[model samples]
Target: MENNTFPLYFNLTMFLNLGSFRYPTFVLCFLLYVFIVSANAVIIMVITREKNLHEPMYLFIVCLCLNSIYGSTGFFTRFLRDLLSDSHLISRWACFTQVYVIYTYASYELTILGIMAYDRYVAVCQPLHYHSRISLRVVYRLVALAVIYPAFSVFTCVYLSARLPLCGNEIPKVFCANWPIVKLSCVPTGLNNLVGMLVSTTTVFLPLLFVLYTYLRIVLVCRKKSSEYKSRVIQSCLPHIVTFVNYSITVFCDVSLSRINVEELNPFLGVILSLEFVVIPPILNPLVYGLKLPKIRKVVFKMLSCLKRCH
Candidate 1:
């Protein structure tokens, strides 16, 4: 961290270690996190309350909303603590908590995306087989995978990767992330680094690759399909394309962290990098799909009217 601030809610027994100018930026980021939370919350409600949206696609979307809400909130909570504090010192436990949360939710989000991509693949590539292959039981199981796999994956990574003891905590990144946490520990974190990075690749790339391949195949089919289904397929696939692009960039940023020194990273670049992962995709995916698909928009309007009347 460029400047110093106390980890919010510090009990005054720990050393604080940030530089001077980081707090204000953290504050601004905090505000943006608040907006993200609010926006995603409304997205979840809209998807859930609107009866017409109770389909597999929208169900996956609602799952995305929940994942984004979880991931972003975990990150911003730590950011909030730092933003409110005047020093950069964070306790070992606090740092671990942040890392665990952010990693778990991120892993969860990636898993969800993979499941969604599979859903789309079935819908588009195997239309006749889609209903049989992707029954309610299967969607429910996919949802379960999205929810449960993160716990298993994150726990495995946290357990297997972080065995070293922390000597002095000068955590490199402003926020606590797995690689950064490994770097902070004085004990040789080389193995941890390698394993952690690999885990990250698995968390990120597996779903990402599936999504890419799924979409690519979908695009091919779209070209061959009747013009009637083309528009809807194109509209649906665009959102996933946008979402995948965002994920690719974010995974790039994270993987790059292992190779670069955080101190040398540019400040403005840092803010944008952090924001890009959650803020960009959730906002863009909904906008791209909801706006392009007239049916979702129409349903949204009807739902809004119903809400208005209820109020």
Candidate 2:
């Protein structure tokens, strides 16, 4: 076949691993998808239903939970389908669409975390001015920035990749990703590489740096306070810190996986690494916030109690 001709569909090679265990894997994955959806939906519902939980912090948690559901749906619907079917081929349009959704989900996660860090910084460092600084207007603007910036940046990257004339159609992973598609291009992809790096830096690293800086300032502020004040700070900040660190590590594993030769690694390990970002954060985010934050914990327990009594 000539390198100029592009295939209509791309084969996702990773599904080959399910050889004898396809049915069991499919059932397990389906249950996981259900759990991710149910957990995140409950968080969103609790936040929106309770008037007392309508603060900026909880609002951002709602956004985070929403993104988890969004991202999980994008991956799981296709993943579950592939696990059951013999064919793992995805159409070019669908492939690009998955890339867009998953990438934007990742970008939104980082941006929201960064915003949460700033919210904490203001609440802890400037208690008297926290309400004025993180007002409803500011929260709306922050949410807007988190949405708009990542959408634009990731759209550009996906747009560039979709325009390329691919020489091959095999994607080694379970999902369609921008980089693997770019690797199949018959022509040089200098422009794609440059833009991918640029987008990654702006969307990923910049937010990471901002989050780190905010936490540093937060730590410094805590140093001057008494034990009681420090205790409160730890209680409030612990969940965000845990969430951020967990997400950062998973993202690092994913980014590192992209650069390395996945073919050389153990197939099970490679698949696990590839699945980390999509699987871990969605499940963990709700658990962390729902358990660690007293307000959310109280509301969740109350809702559960009501359900128990109804039965």
Candidate 3:
């Protein structure tokens, strides 16, 4: 009965008109989840089956798609179930698990993007050294760090929240997130907040800065090149810039919406805003890369033509 007594579950209070819109929302989300998984799977399969695409860049794209699947699975499955259910409560362990997966996915994405930028930088600015510099051993190490560092940082945040004495059980969003759970603690969360800020800086901002720096260096190098060389840079780097910008905006919106007071705002709009990063980026990343990368695009078209012939 005490405020510090930890309950085994907490009710999510963030769905908008759940009873009225349950069926429609569930069907739509189910379809979207299916599409996201399928699209990412097709890209992963194409990359794996094509031996020519077995380079570092394609490997990182595969990792990105894998992360998209990993992250979306954390949110959409439980989300679809809750849409049709009367009770929208999640267990303590489940909430923490979701928190870990979602945040780790976010962190890994930035790391991958940063690595991609570095890959582009090497290919464009130091063409002679690109292959020698970005060896398989180097790529594997970076990939491991991308996966491990985020999980470690998120684990610390979640572990700290787990140790806290919780005084509330209501989450104001459709899914479990690190900050919202921390807000439920009855005790002072200064240390948790501090650790969280540190993690965000190291994981998100640092990687973003690295990406920007790599692009800037690439631009400076491009200024001295011929028109054909400049065009080559644009063809390869443009998609990355677009992907980075798109992801940055959606993620910023997601993080900002989470921290601000939105109880007075339209609940439907708020829910939609929260879901943007999850829904948009997974679908967008693969499509953008598949359409923009010439080699990948040609392979995709060839595969489609073959499928058409068989049918």
TM-score of each: 0.82, 0.97, 0.96
Highest lDDT: which candidate? Answer: 2
Stretch of 10 with least lDDT, candidate 1: 1-10
Per-residue lDDT over 1-311 for candidate 2, one digit per residue giving the tens place of the 0 to 100 score? 54345677998986555678989988999999999999999999999999999999999999999999999999999998988888889987899999999999999999999999999999998999999999999999999999999999899999988888888899888898899889988889999999999989988999999999999998999899999999999999999999999999999999888878778888888889899999999999999999999999999999999999999
- Residue 226, model 3: lDDT of 97
Sorted on lDDT, highest at the top, how do the candidates line up? 2, 3, 1
Model 2: colliding residue pairs = none
> Model 2's lDDT to the true fold?
0.92
Q: Which residue segments of model 3 deviate by more than 4 Å?
A: 1-4, 18-20
Residue 106 of candidate 1: its Cα lDDT?
71
Residue-level lDDT of model 3, residues 168-251, one tens digit each, is 888888988878878877878999989999999989999999999999999999999999999989999987898889889888
Which regions of candidate 1 deviate over 4 angstroms?
A: 1-31, 190-194, 303-311
Every candidate's lDDT: 0.68, 0.92, 0.89
Q: Each candidate's root-mean-square deviation in Å?
A: 5.2, 1.3, 1.4
lDDT score for candidate 1 against the true structure: 0.68
